[model samples]
Target: MSSDKPQNASESELPQAVPVRRRRWAPSLVWLIPVVAAVIGGWLAVHAVLSRGPTITISFQNAEGIEAGKTRIKYKDVEIGEVTSVKLSPNRQSILATAQLSKEAADYLAEDSRFWVVRPRISGGGVTGIGTMLSGAYIGMDVGKSAARKSEFTGLETPPIINADLPGHTFFLRADNLGSLNTGSPVYFRRVPVGQVVGYELDAKGGFVRVSVFISAPYDRFVTSNSRFWHASGVDVSLSADGLNVSTQSLAAIALGGIAFETPLADNAGIPLSDRNFILHDAREKALQNPDREMQPFRLRFHQSLRGLSVGAPVDFRGITIGEVTAIGVEYMPERKDFDMTVDIRTYPSRLDTLSRGSRISGKLSPQQLIGNGMRAQLRSGNLLTGQLYVALDFFRDAPPAKLIVRKGMPELPTIPGDLEELQRVLQRIVKKLDAIPFDNIGQQANDSLKSLQQTLDSVKALSDGLNKETVPQASKTLEQLQQTLEATRQTMKADSPLQQDVRSAAQEVKETARSFRALADYLDRHPEALVRGKEAQP
Candidate 1:
């Protein structure tokens, strides 16, 4: 029994057919971490496969500031993709760059998509992409409207001015020449900058430069069909009757050329619209001096030289400007056998009326009628200091009769001698009158009169000398005898002697006649017409 117990203990402790606890074939909690991790990895792999995006290739002339890993593609200033690779094209003429775009941006890639490198640039409008300097260069993209999907694009050399997101309208400007103007030039509204020039191309057939310009929303409405555009780049200086006019848009505009526009008066101007073409003038005067009515060309032939008269000289009607001299020519007149000056003038007939529009009544009075009514043209002085001459039209009731001559499809205006010529004619008449005076005959008559007067004076002096020498004693005796005779005559006249009475009566009659003559003289002085008709009796 002892031995059996020992063996049983040994067997129980060691080798007894011990029932093996059926090992619950369960995985450890630590092992479960790997399975869950593997399942998540598989799911992420499947999601990544489903979310892969399209790869697009872009061709560029030069890969100036592009790097594959560092450069990013942007749209509306937001990152949308990354550049994967940049390689030289097989032809070596261009560079082919590959970009990987996010799935969200895949739909935006279309046939018309445009891409350009964003870098710091100074354009006529102003400095652009300055912020890109610090951030390094990147690819700028503009989404296209085309519905067709595409994965290849031709890159642009410069940034685009027209885009869907941009809030502006593009218009065309036609200029004879682009002076100091370039792409990105500023467009001004009354000297205030409001737009920019995007591009320009020469029209070979039309012989004009067509510039594309963009104006923002509110300013765009100011562009009308009657709007005038002019170059506002440099300082405009003009010397006129008013004063010196010096004008400029801004300091920046002097360095970079600019365009300016102004609409006509509200009463006469038309409405504004987008995409309308406008003519760009070279100067402000040309733009502002828009004539409201049509002009007619006329010819004037003058006998005097056109030395001071030049193109742009004013044609005045009674001191009011009505036209301008456009051309001056010389011609030899066969009839007159002299060289005549032919002047071509452009006149706005509408200027004759207060309103620019002419009426039928005024239009009926032809230019021929005006010429018949003594309307004539003459040269006048405009500026005495500058010696500039202008044309003057006036009426001279006594002007020589003349007729109109049509030459080269133009009517010739009758011209008369200017005021300077009239003065010369009057001077010549004065000289002729002076020459007709009898100066030699008058001198001979004056000499004879002086000789006769001198002879009479000599005789009177001799008689005075004879009286002083010999007649002194005789004169004393004569005076004594006269005094005695006067005393006797006085006594005889006072008394009633017959001879004295007769003399006294004669003196009284003489006194009476003198009084009558004095009265008549006074009456005649008071009323000289009394000689023609006797004076009326007072009532």
Candidate 2:
């Protein structure tokens, strides 16, 4: 009994032999939760690793509205990437943004791809990105056509004036200066807006401004090889021989500045190739002028005053513009002992060729021969109100003989006095002749003569006074006596008066006696004649 108790106690304390049973093992609910979670987590990790796109770094001048994990990269308003991180570059001169793009955008990470930050902005192009004011700023991308892939890019400070996908043609213009032109300045074709200035920069030589302009489709076809471009920035007001001319593209152009291009009617409008360069003239007048080829420099020296005559004055031939005055100067002539106003002019002989039916002046007639034939340059008033003067060339039949001479490597054309100058000279000569007259001597002699005439007039006045005071009464009495005598004589002559009747009877008797006497005389004279003519008249 003691041994059994010890074994049982030992068995109970050590181990107990149990029968083996084969049963199915199942996982607990708690294990299921944890195992399912682990599977799902592994799946998500593999997906993230496999579907991830390329990471790119963009360097910007400023981070601006960019925020890591908040700012999105978008192409055509669709989100394509997100900014993963933002940090300063090693030089601290720019902000570096690391972006993670979707797998779909990986293939478009080209070398020339453009990126910019979109925000509310107003430029000459008008308001843009205005929705960003409420929706917040985002990265804008313009996919490039380059085949090479790139992981780094430089962000643009401003949105591009033109979109890469926009259908247009880009042209380059070289200008001496940028006159009030901005990036979004409008370009006009026949005063209609067809494009905008995309970009401008100084040329490599820094001699001119190179402007890049993009003309939209359809309108781009109008830009031909012979097209002329000029600034249409403000109102162009000019006065010419025709009249006052005022022109403007539009009110907007007058404010924001603009450019205008036109293909001349007479020119061949050949299509220009890609990346063609054009010259931007300062004014439309200059852009449309016929190109002067083979310019001949000539000088004209005038002895008259050169007032109102300025450089750039038109040099015309019989009302046709053939050249312009390039320079004006004064030179002292030792031989003439006077100063001569020198005008340097550039003339296009081709103008004459066109006018003379393709007969060139230099080929047909020498300048000397032309001058000998009385070709002369004379200053003429171009505008009476503006007092502007232009050089006029014409045949002067009465002009003094002259010759074409060369001095200082420039052909000198002889000049005749202008009409105004000749009139001034004539007046000056008349004034000299008037000055030569003895005016002082004439004044003295006239004074003496006036004194003698005054004395004679005084004597006549005294005689008239005497006649009125004394002699006039005596004369009146005598005239009255004479009138009385004439009245008596008139009464005696009337037949109605007795004395006059008796005189009339006496006169009648005297007349009868005289008639009798005349008859007797006549009879005696007849008898004498009869006696002299013999006895035939006796009866």
Cα lDDT computed for each candidate against the true fold: 0.85, 0.91
Query: TM-score of the candidate numbered 2?
Result: 0.68
Model 1 weakest lDDT span, ten residues long: 266-275
Winner by lDDT: 2
lDDT per residue as tens, model 1, 1-539: 88799888877777557576766788779999999999999999999878877889999999998999889999989998999999999999999999988888988887888999999987655678998899999999998878898888999999986675577677898998899887777899987889888899999797999988898878887777678898998898889899998899987779888899898666344455533888888887778775636677889988876778899899998876788899999999899889988999988766676444545434767788989999999998888788789999898889999887788889998999888767878999999998899978988998998899899889988988898888977999999999999999887777678887888899999999999999999999999999999896899
Candidate 1: regions farther than 4 A off: 1-59, 85-96, 110-113, 123-126, 144-154, 161-163, 240-242, 267-275, 282-291, 298-346, 354-362, 371-403, 407-539
Reference-based lDDT, residue 249, model 2: 97
Worst 10 residues of 2 by lDDT: 530-539
Alpha carbon lDDT at 313, candidate 1 = 94
**Superposed model 2: Cα runs more than 4 Å off:** 1-39, 57-64, 67-69, 84-98, 149-152, 205-207, 237-246, 265-275, 282-290, 301-311, 327-342, 357-362, 397-402, 407-409, 416-539
**Every model's TM-score:** 0.56, 0.68
